[model samples]
Target: MAYQLPALPYDYTALEPAISKTTLEFHHDKHHASYVSKYNAAVEGTDFDKMAIEDVIKSIAGDPSKSGLFNNAAQAWNHSFYWNSMKPGGGGMPTGALASKLNADFGSYDKFVEAFKAAGGGQFGSGWAWLVVDGGTLKVTKTGNAENPLHLGQTPLLTMDVWEHAYYLDYQNKRPDYIAEFLGKLVNWDFAAANFAAA
Candidate 1:
């Protein structure tokens, strides 16, 4: 199937103070829509045309010859994941098995926040910070430009888009503030929990 742009789970104004409707308009309607269209155009009638996006991503991730396809396909997938990674009133420590896992893996919820924020803050440029299951362990990792856990054989549970377009309009150059808002008031722990359970 040709990749399609997924609609935001909530209204454009739902994210409000943290992520403005204007940002969502440009980011989702323009940027994300471009990736989907690009990926479809790039993959048309190719060997990858019928492959699921995840399969295409894994197959082409590190191949230099497929970099263009990889970038579009991966960005399309990543943006979809990014939207679901947050909810209208989501954030704070998770509960149940996922909560215990975070505490176990990162020592405490505070430590997980530290490490997660560090991963996002430390990413040098346009990229993503991820919470993923790697070898049965929960880890925080970052990838530069259209890259994600799928490229590294990990199961992604949650993600934050640290790309400038993700936060620039609202926070200007203060990415740390964006990351803080994401962790404090926008993260969807239930989504993470579901992913963790399946992982």
Candidate 2:
């Protein structure tokens, strides 16, 4: 079956102020939908069509001939993850095992915030910033266009889409402001905690 665009868990206006309705509509309905369509087209009638999205991504990552397939597939997967990475009323400090893990790995919540925001801000261009478990340690990392932690043998716990389309309609040229809101007001700690436990 062809991969389909997943609906946002919340309403278009649910993430307002942090993520505007207009931005959500365009980002989800246009940009993300495009990636899903392209990915389906790329994988149609191919062996990848029979594999899970993650499996396809891992199998073809870094192969020059499969770059197109990888790009669309990764973006499709990334956007799906990105939507759940935030919630209507989320952000601030995390709690439970995930909070403890962040504190242990990064020294404190503030330090973890610094590292995660830095990863998102420091990304040179269209890409993603991730909180991933690498070799059993929590880490902050960034990837250039269409790449993600899965390609690096890491398990992703959370993600922030740093692509221009993700924030341009809302924050304009002020990406730092967008990143700040994403952390202070929009990030979903519950989702991260669940991913952490699973990892």
Q: Candidates' lDDT values, in order? A: 0.95, 0.94
Q: Report backbone clashes per prediction.
A: 0, 0
Candidate 2, TM-score vs. the true structure?
0.99
lDDT of 2 by residue, 1-199 (tens): 7998999999999998999999999999999999999999988898889999999999999899999989999999999999999998898999999999899999999999999889999999899999999999999999999999897889999999999999999999899999999999999999999998898
Residue 94, candidate 2: C-alpha displacement in angstroms: 0.4
lDDT (C-alpha) at residue 78 in model 1: 97
Instruction: Give every collision pair in model 2.
Output: none
Model 1 TM-score, 2 decimals? 0.99
For all predicted structures, in order, the TM-scores are 0.99, 0.99
Cα RMSD, each candidate: 0.6, 0.6
> What's the CA error at residue 152 for candidate 1, in Å?
1.3
RMSD, model 2, all Cα superposed?
0.6
